[model samples]
Target chain A: MNHHAAQSRAAYLFLTPFLALFVVFLIYPLVQSLWLAFQQTHGPSITRYVGLDNFKSIAVDRLFWKAFWNTAVFALASVCIQLPIALGLAMLLNRPDVRGRAFFRLIFFSPALVGLVFVAVLFGLIFEKRTGLLNVTLHAVAGFDPEFPWLQQYVMPALIIAALWLYAGFNMVFFLAALQNVSRDLLEAATVDGAGPLRRFLHVTLPAIRPVGSFLVLLSLIGSFQLFELPYILLGGGGPDNQGLTVVMYLYQAGFDAGDLGYASAIGWTIAILLGGFAVAQRYVSALDER
Target chain B: MTPTLSITPRRTLAKLSAACLTYAMLAASAAIVLTPFAYLLASSLKTGEDFFGSLFLPAGEGVFGVAWGRITSANYTRLISEFDFTNNIVNSVFLASTTSILATLGAAMGGYALAMIRFPGRRFVTNLVLFALIIPAALMLAPSYQLLYFLGLLDTYTGLILPAAAPAFGVFLFRQAFLSSLPPQLLEAGRIDGCGELRLFVSIGLPLVRPMIGAFVLITYLGTWNNFIWPQIVLQSPEKLPLSVAIAQLRGVYSQDYGLLMAGTVISIAPVLVLFLLLQREFIAGLTAGAVKG
Candidate 1:
């Protein structure tokens, strides 16, 4: 074979493993998920077509709505609460006068490496009623309630606190990088123009980091929507009154726990659509902001 | 940027106070962030009684008013002996390492082809990879489970490892890394030197993207190591379960055994954290590289 033919042959050979696996695992499963959403199945077998019944049931599904609301709350908290603190920390670290930047950065970023499952395991105990670290510390510091039912009464807040610890620093790293790349000249120009610290930050820093900020928001949203392992393990499957039910956890329960793969696929489809909507909305907002 | 305004005494005092406030916040935040890990470590050493007795370390008639004598290794011992966590640990090691290595090689190869090679349908494959990026893993859980069952790969490592080996995210990252770093001329040079295709890839293509390899391997390894849901669904046999599932199950069975649970948590977290500490630069760069660049 000539060089062109030979190179093409070699390229296909190189692509074989990834292509094969991608087809079998990703493409096939994705298409099958779309198909499976319309039909109910017992385990992996005994499927029956139910048209739009799965989606219809999920439409009025109070449990699914609760899961969606909980997930939305978490995502909102991530963007509003977590990302602001992250950006604030990033601003702190990005200061030219700051010392031990790397040390603080490492400390802040460490929990993110703990992974979601392990974070749940650790926080599972940390959110305990009286002896839990949170309650004890709060009780000592501010006369807070020692017997506050975190996993029971304040399930969403408990999940939010755990997620904040897990993700704030991770998001901070991104913000820090974006902050570092902010045009120093423009900031100095704003300072020279007698803009206050807040004003300068508003005009220069905020606009500059908007892209990364939005990206982090979308990422946080997608991640929040798929909140399964953390809540599943932390609350031990949708805590009291199913207050901690997440979309993916609900999907898992429907699929594995309840052995209804079809309903699970429908939930999966709903999550996909919601996430895709977030992506598009984010893109549109970012595009508008650029103008 | 020089100070356009003169530094009055009031300004100096303000700056100093601001610095002090910044330090205070950073210190407090760091403490809050690290308190749980400390709590985990201390809890793992305390018995069930001591767990309720003290917040962190048990307080007693020891140095610093701490009950050092009450610290115990029984939790770790129980994890291995009574709970058979050692088998889970081994299974985790096997699955994580194998999956990571295979994934890195597969992604590097596929990415190299997409980035460097001139062939038919390259655009289609590249677009396919890009399209795959937005398809969330959660979307595939149910169907993939059924597919695995149909293939009779459930309860086996192959079911878990094979799907993860060719992650679209890894391939896209590797593709970006190669496009930015790997030189077309270098590959041409290797070709002119009469190197075989495989040799050119293994020797020349691989070394050019070493940092990507490091980052991708660490990412994949850490991902597989910490992954819970997929394995929980796929693996039915207890012995085949990795540490993630094993730890969850451990908690399920012995939720009240705070020490044992914390001990298991420590085992699950320590290795990956240490690996991250060692290779944090590459890992962080790899992680944020995608968001910042893409």
Candidate 2:
């Protein structure tokens, strides 16, 4: 009885800091945000219970819908472009016969290590209309006009490119590590049985790395939804005509700019639900595949 | 030994084609990845005239000769003196280091307890941590900002470091590392030697999980250093801002000074690059280890 009592005390002691911090920072904020979602605040202190009105406002708001669509487009485009390229790079770097693999891996992964703000700044320069390097290069190489605004016509694509550059290498490292864990004997046996490289990859490699792929896909999806800095910096926080405004950026603007804390809270809850639903769906899909 | 193996022409062609394709793809990918960085470097080196005139090409006048002329450390000097870049660097370094150490220590204790000691509510605690991980950070923004305001920690380093130090990801990563990498006999031996739980963690558990600790330190430090939005909201004073926020301020104030902007960026990115280069192997190992466990 003493031992059990001592153990429980120790457990609580061990958990105190994390639980305290979580309550103060995470859980309190979480509950408060939900509360704020329902209660309308005129200023910082003026609060009134408005029930579902804030959520209703969010549902009908055109800017909210635009931001939602923008976010969805950004997320989908980023995942579709990044995953296959990262997988292919991982496969190439995973090959035993490849020389200078470490150097290639390092170069590839270098961009990801750089802060997102730096990446945003770099791409911002590159995508500049008149004096930017990208425009200059296009003019020199293909005689393309330098006056064209890359961000205006190609906002999503430009963001997707930046996303791919920053993330593909990082994701490649994960895939490479997962690929390394595939049993060498199985691959060797497949090769010995006259299976081609592509055949071996399809039949053996794909199965072994499927879990990693699923995890990356899910992570990328979540990351895509939370996308903020790159678009914020590159396009000047929602760019021309709010074309670049992602959901998180919109949420930030609403909370900070519009001071619509209640409405922003609704958006936050909506994002959480969407992300959670997708993650659960992905897990289900993975389980079904296993079965 | 008697039979000479001969490759078929079709097989040879297929192999050659595959090799060529791989090379082409890698080259293209590398080009795309490196172009923006290359542009930044080139632009930084070009004269103002060359910057506007031949922006795509390398300047005939070197970085020193262009604009400020003769390799002036002017931009960097200005970055430090005018922007208080030095202070921002110190603030970032201090915040990152403190967060890393506090977070690692907290996680180490939590992870060791969860992994080695059997206690009631273990499953519940683990599930809660996982739930924390899945919850979007944006959800916590408004409330956390308000809480920080209430505590009178707004614009202070404590505001930046404390909220970040309590990240669920660190605990999750450490727990996963402990489960897989830590051996049971060591803990038993420590207990047998009459070592207390805390001592066992400090002496035995810590050394065993050095790699994970290293990994957590890097991830935590980098994440804190690069954080933009939270700091943007919390930090009101320009001097208190980290490099990420400072760089954004540069954008707002000196939007036209591409050279200076790129210089600031290059300066901002240098430490991370150096750290990455030094710890490339450990970084990869840490990432792979985390992914596998997740």
Q: Which model scores highest in lDDT?
A: 1
Where model 1 places Cα greater than 4 Å from the true spot, the runs are A278-291, B1-13
DockQ for all models: 0.57, 0.50
Q: Write the per-residue lDDT of candidate 2 for residues A125-227, one digit (tens) a residue.
A: 8888877777777888899998877898778888887788899999998898889889998998887788887998999999998878887877787888889
List model 1 lDDT by residue over B1-294, tens digit each: 446667889889988998998999999999999999999999999886787998888899999999899999999998899989989989999999999999998999999888888998988998788778777678899999999999999999999999998887778788888887889899899889998888888898888888888999998998899899989989999889999999888888888888998999999899999998899888888887766654
**What value does the lDDT take at residue B239 in candidate 2?**
69
| Displacement of the residue A11 alpha carbon in candidate 1, Å | 1.9
| Pairs in steric clash, model 1 | none
Candidate 2 lDDT at A219 equals: 79
lDDT of 1 at A255: 91
Compose the digit string of candidate 2's lDDT tens values, residues B9-81. Answer: 9867977887777777777778877777777766665545556665544434566444334334567777778
Candidate 1 true-interface contact recovery: 0.68
| lDDT of model 2, residue B130 | 69
| CA shift of A197, model 1, Å | 2.1
Itemize residue pairs with steric clashes in candidate 2: B64-B69, B64-B70, B64-B71
